[model samples]
Target: MSAYKSADQYRDIAGRLALPSQAFIDGEWSAAAAGKVFENLDPARGTPLGLIASCDGSDVDRAVAAARRVFEAGDWSRAAPEERKAVLLRLADLVSAHAEELAVLESLDSGKTIKDCLNEIGHEVPTFFRWYAELIDKSFGKVAPTAQNIVGMIVREPIGVVGLVLPWNFPLLMAAWKLAPALAAGCSAVLKPAEQTPLSALKLAELAMQAGLPAGVLNVVPGFGETAGQAIGRHMDIDAVSFTGSTEVGAYFLKYASESNLKPVGLEMGGKSPMIVLDDAAIDDTLVSSAISAAFWNGGQNCSANMRQIVHTKVKDAFLDAVVDKAKALVVGDPLDPATDLGSMVSEEHRARVLSYIEIGKAEGASLLAGGGASAGLDGAYVDPTVFDNVDPAMRIAREEIFGPVLGVIGVNSAEEALAIARDSDYGLHATVFTQDLDKAFHLAKRLPCGTVAVNGFSEGNVTTPFGGYKRSGSLSRDNGTEAMDQYLQTKTIWITLK
Candidate 1:
């Protein structure tokens, strides 16, 4: 009797796509300096998808050197803003051209639904580049107030070699957020993608090169967080480091940058955001639709996902019922399935973490309104959509980030109490204030201590609008319209006298 199971015991998509297993540096893909590798797992099935190149300190140096070379060469950053604009535009076009393939790959790797992947690749990802492309030349300096004889202009220049560390939640979208503006502002970069989902970023580097981004102008290195992430933070030649991840790690990078070179650090950290439903809010269709979007979209992994819901006591019961009903109706399954509304978490560990939080909710006197288990027959990493009612504002479930399909419903006495509860968290990433009254909406909007506030509906912002957080968020402002490009630039003033 054979004790071993056949290879067919597990699902395989290796033949579907030959995943890149190398660090992309100076326009070429190669193994890490140490010849190490990391296994990326399929979140849906809790199986090893494949081994990808794992880089460390030496690898980080190579990438930084490449970026530095490109910066010094001025082949990309020194190109005329018009020409740079053209290249960025072309890059966006290429992303659009490969939108289908990118979406499939992202879905396979990230465990997000194909529909969401398509939306990211087709819409969010490309829009950043396209918007920044036009803004390349437009991102000029403003003339500071000065005496006529002593005129001065705060001209923006490339921020030199930048290190962009992107999160796994929305790999392509987050990378685009950094890359588009950084490239637009004439900076070369070394991109370190989340180890869990590095495929899309490597693919994107290839696309950028094909669109005429010069060799060494961009590099992608995948590795462990302690190794590559820290290396990027401490690299001497790196002028700036922009990151999006948990607040715990963001703090580490912030300190690393300060200790390393006092290099400017941009961090977009964690959130326990509140979604306020006012007494006058439209409940039946519009309010329910917005609530569903806030709680469950993107599998509740979004940094800006409405984790905490504060409903006015008068309408709390009705709101909870509506939210639970809608959440229960969501289809959870394989990401490749077009109809699947909710996909698996990024990994089994994350899935377990989420479920544990659900358990915590129950133990802490919160009510499980709907969903609290694995799908009956699903093979991949599928967790049922879950909602908790009678949750206290102080409960761990309500305050901490689960990053799963779990919602915590809290009732507040009034809109003022709602805002107070919403503002009580350590995070100020984002919040949505739903109300039919304009005065109430605006009042709540101004009072909420988040980087972005959505009135009447969830925020549907374009690349031009600013999107960032307040306290404990980060040092730099991001997504503020064209201002996103500012992080990638430095300022220089030149004085001259006409002969």
Candidate 2:
């Protein structure tokens, strides 16, 4: 009954894109130094898309060397801010022009729904570049007041070469989050796309070259995290590394940085975010839809996905029933289908991990209200939208990051109990509250120890606001908005004595 594209249609789309397979370095595409390659599979069909270059530490070294050369040459690093802005704006235009191609590649590569790929990845990717491009000209340094005729000035400068490690979910969008700000600040970068999803990053690198970015300004290396990622973290020449991945890997980046160059590392790591529905909430169709979307969007692979849904004990049963009904209604099938509400997980390995977590949830005494398994009749890595009731705050599924389409509902006696339940987590990236009471919304918003809290809605944030986590969810620096540029910039103080 779904209006999904056939296999042949998808294949024709793929052929038209002709996505790049080689790693992009110094404005050119080339094979890995060792000529090793890895198969990139379409997660929905489990078919091989192509073999991508499998880079290693040596490739990372080459990329870093090239980036360093460009940084020293001042082609981009010393260019005028307006000039950098112009190039980024042009790149944004190119991204818009090739939106359909990129959307096809993204859905095929990462198994995200084609609708989301086009809207979130394809359309939103250019916004980051354009936002940062316009912001470049506005982020000026300050002239500070000083004692008795002595003039002091503070100026921001790029931190030389940077290393960026991206995650599998929202590949190109996440890349834009880091890439836009770094380039706007005049920093050269060596980017390592996750091995599972590297096609879009490589494609973006090609587009950057076409947009007039100087050679070495942006480089993409695709490989295993243990090799290229570790090399980037440990490389003494890489001034800083901005990473978005697991908290465990984030800790490793810190260790590598400390053990090597002691470079400043910025991490946008994992999250076990929560969504609280107060008894006084509107409880309309919109509220129910938002709750379901928060848990199942992007197949729940989002780092900031709300895994825990805390509800008032009074309205718990009704809310649970509505959520369960909605979960059961989701269409899980080919991601390329415009009507598909849910798509495959990023890979078979990840699907297995999510399935195991469902079993664990059942074993831990959480009642499975709706679904706890893969979709019926689907050969791909498709997981049904799952909801668990009576999930204990102490349970692993409640406390840890599942990174799937699994929602754990916990009932609370009062607002106090809800606050306690939401705060008791190692990860604090994003949370949402559904309530009509203004006082209650602000009260909960002020107390939640997360980086962002949405009242009466569930969205990460807009371009103007900053995004990052508290505690283990992220580093001191934030991503998106004007604050993101700070991560790639350093300040210097200059003082002059007047006669």
Candidate 3:
């Protein structure tokens, strides 16, 4: 026997990590009014990981009240940029110091490989904080046109208290995306993590507190969407709300904002992103590699996964053949196994959903090139890496977001047709076009209606680059670069005559 046969045999040192269990309100761990609890499950084996305190609408009210008090206090907001940067810098240091514990907990909660989580997500955490810290001091307002002695100065001020809702797929990374910019911009926040993955966010709150963040500055409440999420959406005291999740949930937040406070809503929603392979594209290893990248990472759960493959008709068959061969080689098994190339879906329900979509594709007469079933001999949730050939642009598989390990191959007669096929989706979150022609690459890159485009390269970016979708895929306020700070800030103008 190779060490422990099952995950149960290996004790998760990460779960026993010391972190506060109470709802972080007013900068401390406080219990909910009802003190109700909910169980967080390990999706890999469908086992209980831990019981987290559940927050209801009433608890959200209290948290919002606390956040508003802190925002109004202006201790952190009105303070100098250097002071804010110092606090955030300290928080980043603490995160780096506890990197291993955080990585282990993330892996345990999300069913991702511990190695991948530690290497990618854990390492990126500190960089994000450090990047935002440097930007804080350099960020300043602009002076607009004014007549004569009348000066029009547009200054960025904290946008009051914000309600940040994070998805389960990449808990800490998404939080870092939202939290770093929001905190650096001097906004107090009430954060609600996905009910399924609350451990990391709870742990994060503890670290933030330890890093000298004052009470009521950052509060994390773990609860269900209907109760806690809806409460945050409609909360009167909340100045804004930033969310990252499915298109349906994102739509609901928008409607709630419209009906309630007419507050600004920042959403990073679903994506049916496309990858275009042009006629001039090299038919070698790079083509195969891009195909694998589109529909494999995180079991293809990424919002920007290269789910839709728009290939030139000249090399369409050849590209599809290469992709099928590469995809079939993927090894699906226990997430802890270092050799496992693919991991489980977030949950059994999500696995079933992915499978159902595959069935729908078959029903619509799309050719199943490879992997249309669950992997055999795996006790945990494991779906085969799927690929559909001869898929029509109009098919549901091509139009909608599967959020699974499925790739849709669409054949186009020309480079124009390829770009057309790629753009013919409601989601413009991300797209990649592969071609050796620099003119064609740059031309398609500008013409494609996505928020971010990659020519020759697949979906990629640093914490400093802006990442969001266009049209229905993302909101105006959630871009990730220097502009990200704008989401948590409101422009203010202060004018005075010479003393």
Candidate 4:
């Protein structure tokens, strides 16, 4: 019924794309220093996509040296803002020109639905480039008022030689979130994409060169976290490191920075975000659909995913019925199929981890309201859209970040109870509330201890709004919007005495 092509058609397109398999450094694709490689598998079918360069600390050092050289040479770092903006705009245009190829590569490499890869990430990636491109020329330094005999000015300057470490969930989009703003701030960068999903990032590096980005201005080294990632975190030459992944890994980055150069580190880490549905929420199909989409979008691999659903007791039965029914109706199949709503996890290991959590939920005594196992007749890393009801706030399934298509529903007696339950988490990344009363909506919005909150909506902040987290969910640095450029820039105050 869907207009999407078959599995064979996707294979043909993927072959035509012929995504690069080597690490992108300086300005060329090259083999690893040790000539080592790692296999990338299609999670949808467990088939080998290709081999990516298995870079290690030596490769990271080379890439960082290249970035530092470019930064010190003042090729990109000293370029005029307007010129940098023009080049970034050109890169955005090229991204649009090769949208389909990038989307296919993302879906194939990350095991996300092709439809989402095309519609969500495909569109968002270029928009981020364009957004930062426009900001580059408009953002300016400030002149501070001073004493009559003195002139003071505050100028924002790019921090040299940034290291960007990306996550696998939204490979290209997350890369854009870091790369766009860093480049706009006139910083040279060495990026490390996740080992599980390296194809799209490599392709992006190639496209950057095509857009006239100078050699070493932007480089990507793909490999395991212990090697390439740790090197970036611990590198003395890198002025700052921007990372997006789990809290455990984020803490490690902090340690790496502390033990090395004490460089600035920005992290957007894990979450167990809550979706609160009040008793007075409009009991409509739209509300049910929005709640479902919030928890399962991108197969719930999002760090801001609303894995916890706290519903008021008055409408608990109705909400649970609708949510469970919708979860059951979701079609889990090959990611290439347009009709499939839920696709496989990023890898077999992740699938097993999610399944183990399901068993843990059962052992911990949460009621299995909907799906609780793998999809029938599929051998890939597919897991059904799972829902667990009668979940306690202290349950492992409710408190932890599943990072999968698993939703836990907890019933609350009042608005006070819902707020208390939502705030009882180490992560303060994202949360949402569904209600008709403006008083209740605004009240919850102000009290919820998260970086982002939506009333009667499901989306996180957009390109115009700042996106990050509170507590352990993120660092002081924020991403997106005009403020994101601040992460890669430092302020210097200059004063001159009048003659």
Report the C-alpha lDDT of model 1 over 294-339, residue by residue, as the tens digit.
Answer: 8788898888888788888888888887888899899998787766
TM-score of 2: 0.97
Candidate 3: clashing pairs of residues:
26-216, 27-216
Where does candidate 2 have its weakest 10-residue lDDT segment? 1-10
Residue 92 lDDT, candidate 4, scale 0-100: 92
| TM-score for each predicted model, relative to the true structure | 0.95, 0.97, 0.94, 0.98
Candidate 2: tens digits of C-alpha lDDT, residues 1-499 = 1244554676578777786899998888989999999999999999998999999999999999999999999999999989999999999999989877888898999999888877865568899999999998998889897888898999999999999999999899999999999999999999999999998899899899999999999999999989889999999999999999999999999999999999999999999999999988877798899899899999999999998999998889889888898899999998887878999999999999999999999999999998899899999998999999999999999998999999999999888889999999998899999988899999999999989999888898887889999999998889998999888999999889999
Arranged by TM-score, best first: 4, 2, 1, 3
Point out the higher-scoring one by TM-score: 2 or 3.
2
lDDT of the candidates, in the order given: 0.84, 0.92, 0.84, 0.91
Residue pairs whose backbone atoms clash in candidate 2: none
Estimate, for each residue in 1-499, the C-alpha lDDT of model 4 and write its tens digit: 1256766777678778887899999998899999999998999889998888999999989998899899999889999888899889999988888877887888889889888887755578889999999998888788888889988989999999999999999899899999999999999999999999998889888889989899999999999999999999998989999999999999999999999999999999999999999989976888788789888888889999999999998998998889889999999987877777988999999999999999999999999988899888999998899999999999999988889999998999999999999999999999999999999999999999989998898888788888999998999898898878988999999999998
Candidates sorted on lDDT, descending: 2, 4, 1, 3
